[model samples]
Target: MMATIVKGGSFVIDSSSWESIMTPEDLSEEQTLIAEAAEHFIENEVLPHDGELEKLDYKLTVQLIRKAGELGLLGVDVPEKYGGLGLDKVSSTLISEKLAKGSSFALSVGAHVGIGTLPIVFFGTPEQKRKYLPDLADGSKIAAYCLTEPSSGSDALGARATAKLSDDRTHYVLNGAKQFITNAGFADVFIVYAKIDGKHFSAFIVERTMEGVSIGPEEKKMGIKGSSTCPLILDQVKVPVDNLLGEPGKGHVIAFNILNIGRFKLGAGCVGAAKDAISLSAAYANERTQFGKPISSFPLIGEKLADMNIATFVLESMVYRTAGLIDAVLQNIDHGSDAAGVQSAKGIAEYALECSINKVFGTEALDFVADEGVQIHGGYGFIQEYKIERIYRDSRINRIFEGTNEINRLLITGTLLKKAMKGELPLMEHAQSVQESMLEPTEQSDTDERFAQEKRLLATAKQIFLLVGGQAVQTYGLELEEQQEVLARLSDMMIAIYAMESALLRAEKITAKSGEKRGELASIMTSVYVHDTFASIERAAKQSVAAMASGDLLSLQLSVLRKWTRHTPPDTIRLKRQVAEKVKAAERYVVV
Candidate 1:
């Protein structure tokens, strides 16, 4: 496909290959050992016990999770002072990936650590942290977040649960039921949100031992059965005033922000599962013969493998970039109790759009990858014995939980528009700066060629946003959910473009030091990323713009958009094979 060009900017092609950009990072001995330890634990401890745990045996589930905590895997992202390893987000994501190889057992651990405990670490009071977090961090006690009720799934503020302050003012009387809570049977601590005064919400840290607190029988789910999921019944339970998580009427803050972190971790897990799915398909294709030869040798199978690799790569790139952005925001700040910590909220709040974007993309991408994985395996993929079968079922919840992807789509668009309105996004500034930085071309190779393509795609995407986003917001407004979908597509186009731009820029800098071979490969991958991403943006822009139109302009613009089909990327099959080979060789998902 021919490349699209920006009017005021152009790509400076440097001769280099993706190999330079794709060079692996050097890990410290500790990092390597930690990852290996996680892998070993999953293969040995978790996989063997998957059957019994899947039956909802609370005792066995808690024991295994505690064992994981003992291995220091549960507290990888927790601070040292809080009984955690205080590792970086990438490392935590790696741990998540490894645990995912264990299937739902990984999910069990994730529930206890990621969504369940992160809120306390990020937003709890000193007393609350000291009271509940220590046990949670050490795995002595499990934790669960209670947000979804019988009626409140995505519309959290629509919750009917009530927590009325007692006449004595010492405790709050809670009367509500939270359904489909993970770690329900095992959690000793629950972060429950309840309405106060009929107009406001509050978060309360309730213990299982509290009076009138009970757990319902486990609900049989479509997947992730190993993780206990049941209802938390709180009938006139007495929660002390001290147990209130944050100030009254501020529970939405905790619910929304902690959920952002959960979405990222969920995306990371999807990446891990996608890798496994891809590997399974690739290996099966190589071994299983069809048409008198291995299926892997055929273009059809090759295309599927390529598509899987590209999807995985895009997701990993986006996930890590989002993580790195969040890490940057949370880096110097202390994530302890104390209201002073809230003063630094600007950092994390700024990236809400990015977080939601990753959630939507990662979940949807994994779903696509899983479906394709099954298709690649043909009938074998559908059978229960095949891990893909389980993975396909397990993957469905990611979109539903942590805010349904439908809600997340609204968030992605709303957040982006909000940011843009507030001047936080500066999409134009980002575009201009990237173009300026690449004005002077360096050298040339295969990787450099790819880098050039990535730039072209990004530049085109920026243009589309400038033209389309403004038109939609002015015409459709926020009330129309379809506009939100359009905004989501626009944001995705920008995100993919940004990822490619960043990776290409990094690859160029890396190549300058690593030599041409590595540089060439990085460039190739960058181009591959750009090509795939641009095509997506082009399609979305065309569809969205046409949908927004009321008159003949719709058909006219679509026809024009179709005429520009020369802008798509290279054969994805070959590009994905290259990506898969790297993933298999490293046994992990990575961009480089």
Candidate 2:
């Protein structure tokens, strides 16, 4: 099958070679060793202190972060010149995934490595990097990102913070309150975004010792309480001119580009957290007996476990595939070049759609895994003593973090449309082809019988998406921005499409490597995911078409959608049982 992808504002998808993408199964020996080290750190340091960390022990949290830095876990993406390991995106993703098992401690490290430090790594000046990167890399200085204000959450540009130039042009006086600042209570550095003279939006590096900089009392939260979340009060804090990050009035560039990286990393973290939840839930089921057998022996409980494993598999596949794609693009750029920062940011931004898709899909998948885990634990799941309970709470914030799932959904379609408008992606042309296909009888394409049905369903899902999405775009034009519900539905279809494709490709790769017999489990899981998600794709497409069209037009579109979506539903019960047997035997997620 052919596909188009936008990278660095250009189309880079080669139809004939489109199937080549990385998967978790491709991890190298060295990468595996790095992941093992992170796992060891989590087991030795983070997990043992879970209780103390939960009690908001800021000192222990800082100590843990420093320990991670000492172990080189905090500098996976930073350049070696900056006292970092300067690893690839995949390695960084692996670290994020492993750290996620640490629970709230993972959030502390994630914010530090992602939003907190990337601005300097990606956009800071030579002096800025020289002064801060070493300390950040070595964990001597902890960092926090101050973006959301009480008045601004998703509307980040609406921040009330103001920075004014001093009379001598030596410093900018910053005044504002940033709410829910992660790592606020203990972070030594903060990436603050404030409007200059209440006009030009910008970002600044503010030190904890700066005059008039103070953190409010930590907010008692629902989840991840081990990580500090507080309001930062900048009461006429004077930040030196040298601390300005990026260019004046161009803070959004940093804010957004860094967020793209954060979104994918957040997805990777979710994958790790989901795996942890699956392991705990499966172990609990194996131990807890009801009637004559363990709860895991029950089909209903087994089904839940199977579903969790399946979702985690798909999420892991997508996360690594994206990381590999980003890494491949970034590897070609010289990190020391003057324009490297811009090039790097563009490289990451190239897959903004995929990043947002991963964020929305991975977080929701983790939430599902966590919820089912709690369900499998029954009453024990609700008790704080149970790890599942804390996991349930911790998973809640992911949807709202990076960007709200809603915002990310909008971004998914919005970015695709922008790329289409810029001629960077041929989405419109593909949509036009789908529209044309609807006018004629369906034409069959040859494929290996092993995945023929899935391949066909995937193609149809894309058609449904293009049909509805194209109609919406044409009907509303620029006003399509207001059709958020329709746009969200379209985003759902795209998310499902991407998820299914990732799983299918991974399964195909494994099957090719190990043959059909050895790859049976992957084939089963992929089939289950693709078949089930195709139904969801059809539903979302139909809903979008219904909302955008009416009467005869809506009816006609629905008919065409049905034609494309037609497929025999697989025996998912049998598939789930097969998946469950593997998961049960392994005592955890075993797709890898």
Candidate 3:
């Protein structure tokens, strides 16, 4: 075993004690317009047809997507030059989230617009763009990305499907299959990746009209059943020479780059779904009575509601932050340049940690929030007629499809560490201040005691990230093959910490100008969040450290476990009421 040793003296100031910069802001004018427009389309078009869609009416689903296109929702991310609305990444995310209020319909629409069509829009040649993008942007044609094989779920690049190049190399004969493909049953254009020459991979724009292309019966799923998912079969599917996307032997780039965009969009969708779930939970809690009173009146139920709101708030902030970062990168790419934003890769790469972090944290957070929503409802949550049940079911796939949380965890931790090792992060001035205040902690505010612990854990985590992340890159050569899981965990923790910090920071701002009530909520929530995060981060750090260290592994594990237990704080049933009331008053998830 090659044990990696990291010097412990490399210090990052535990600045989590400082106020956070992450918080959910009101949508900008354009974002509000886009969100409302999407909401209107979903309410008017999708909700009314739920009965038809439940029967697996493909025609109805197709019609609805077309209507979405007509409303310009489909083209939200496309440029105006290509018949799209030419919206930025934030707009797309906002639209996706708002549409998610419609549940499965939101997913169906997201699938058609995001994974189905974005690759061609971003990486396609002008002729290719002219050929496919217009239909995709107009929602006249549906799209799908075929990369997952039965044997290769998250290991997409290791797909077994093969495509053979002809003797003239003018065209390729594709022979392979893609399984569990979203929108497989109805997509007009398929972005299929296959191994060529037995080693290199290539991407092709395979159409449904192709001679040897077919879709198997839809696979029954736990949720999102209304959105078609099935196997895409290619039996000697003869693809045209011009159908090739990007260069030969470079399909991995196309697959991964597009996937990066897909994951980010998927994160946006989760944020939307999370918001919807919280809304549903709050409404249900406010109405449904138990023990002769509205369930929302109970402290435990109130806490659950508060948790749901806070989790959603975290997701929204992180999703938009990621959108802002990705937008800056995509916009900086000169349209006239043939470089295809390769030089601007650092922009996306800079947030790779954030993207995967959001993917894991946001999805899992929503899952927990939704589950609690169902729990609070008691029996109605499980009934088929209730939307919460469907939302719960639909939410399950979000964590699984867009790179399982397991895979995402690795990417998150690995990316954070790698970035640190590469010295890409500019160092902030190191400082620490401890102030003892008797002020009660608020719902989203950080208590000094709790904040201090988080600061220490984050500082240590950054060190571990650099140590393990640097060694992994050096040994494994930056593909993140072996170090993915560790990276993912690290990334998840970072996102949670970031979200918690953001909420706390925002609460502080509100409290400073406002009265004690707001400040109290902020302080209490902050205490709970910061302390909880401190414990979680410490656990993850200890695990990663143990994985890299050469000491008595069992002893290290027990020490970390004991450390966590010793630091854990008492349960806050009282503090939760403050969080619940604020969220209820706002009628949605408000940062404070």
lDDT of all the models against the reference? 0.71, 0.89, 0.69
Per-residue alpha-carbon lDDT of candidate 2 for residues 1-592, written as tens digits (9 for 90 to 100): 3223336322212121225778888899989999999999999998899899989898999998998999999988888877888888999999999999899999999999999999999999988998999889979999999999998999999999999999999999999999999999999999999999999999999999999999999999989988999999999999999999989999999999999999999999999999999999999999999998999999999999999999999999889888878987788788866567678888899898889999999999999999999999999999999999999999999999988999999998889889889887788888787788796887655465888898888777777777887899889998999999998998888888788888888898888887888778888999999998988887787777777789998888888877777667779999999999888888888974
Each prediction's Cα RMSD? 6.2, 2.3, 7.1
**Candidate 1 lDDT score at position 373:** 83
Ranking by lDDT: 2, 1, 3
In candidate 3, what residue range of length 10 has the lowest lDDT sum? 429-438
Better of 1 and 2 by TM-score: 2
lDDT of 1 by residue, 451-564 (tens): 555555555566555555655765676555565667677666655554565456555655666666766546556667677667787878786787688577666555545544
List where candidate 1 sits over 4 angstroms from the true fold: 1-30, 335-346, 426-450, 477-482, 502-516, 519-525, 550-592
Candidate 3 root-mean-square deviation in Å: 7.1
TM-score of 1: 0.86
Candidate 2: Cα lDDT at 375: 100
